[model samples]
Target: MIDSCRSKADFAALRRGRRFDSELLWMSFAADAGLARPRVAFALSRHAGTAVVRNRVRRRLRALFREHADDLAPGRYLVGTRGAASAVTYRRARAELARLLETAGAFPRIKRTPT
Candidate 1:
């Protein structure tokens, strides 16, 4: 199961980590050797929307993260929404987040055998 980043240190460590951005959101990832599972946190600015809208966006991101947890590296991730994210459809947001995660090397590279 996916875990939530709850420590202040974890959040602070993201400053030293790699980041990937998209029109809908930005993601930061910090590899932690001590972790067996990935931990994630979400940040939504007031400019993104009202509480209800922000919560909806947050929920969508969380669901996407959970759905792809097994494919992600063991690390701490901070996902923040952009203003555009407030109105994005779930499919569009998923596509954007998938691209960001791929860019950030969150998924392990698959080695191919010569056929």
Candidate 2:
């Protein structure tokens, strides 16, 4: 199993000065302090829906991310749902994420500083 580097600080540190829009959600790799592997922090705002709906959105995004973790290079990613994401299937989500990754300059080379 992929070690989950779940930590509140990890997510918090990522949001310090990062900026994003409807197009993508991303964060660089952050050390778990507790675990060596990088973790993910998804951002599904209340604007997305009610708690039940928000949880469902997160759940779906998590499952989709879990399914495609292998393709994503190591990073403490912050995922935000774009306008397209609201209506995408799992397959579409994966493809859209891949496209975003490419657009974000994440591929060809994933830049990393000392963590």
Candidate 3:
């Protein structure tokens, strides 16, 4: 299950973890050996936009993470965004987020051949 990073320490730890930037967002993630599931937090700064835009961005990020929570490695992940993120479509956000996750080694190595 995908859980929220509720503590300041956990957020700090993720902030210090692996960092990657997509066109629309920034992602920081660190693998946790002890974690039974992945935890995630979204940081939409005031500079990003107005309250409505920020909340929209937050909702999209959370949805993207939750939808793929089962595929992610056990870790603490934090996603942040700038004003540009507010303009992105859900499809683009998901695609970029997936790329970041893959680069962070969040997926298993299982492969399937083309039929």
The numbered model that scores best in TM-score is 1
- The TM-score measured for candidate 2 stands at 0.58
Off by over 4 Å in 3: 109-115
- List the pairs of residues colliding in candidate 1: none
Instruction: Compose the digit string of candidate 2's lDDT tens values, residues 1-115.
Output: 2444367766666666244333433334432344434366666676666677667667776786666555555456677664433464566666766666565443433456897
Clashes of 3: 0
Arranged by TM-score with the best first, the candidates are 1, 3, 2
C-alpha lDDT values of all predictions: 0.87, 0.56, 0.84
- Give, for candidate 3, the lowest lDDT window spanning 10 residues: 104-113
Clashes of each: 0, 0, 0
Q: How big is the positional error of residue 85 in model 1, measured in Å on the Cα after superposition?
A: 3.2
Predicted structure 1: lDDT: 0.87
Q: At residue 96, what lDDT does model 1 achieve?
A: 92
State the RMSD for candidate 1. 1.9
My TM-score estimates for the predictions, one after another, are 0.90, 0.58, 0.88
Model 1 lDDT per residue over 15-63, tens place: 8899889887899999886889999999888888888888999999899
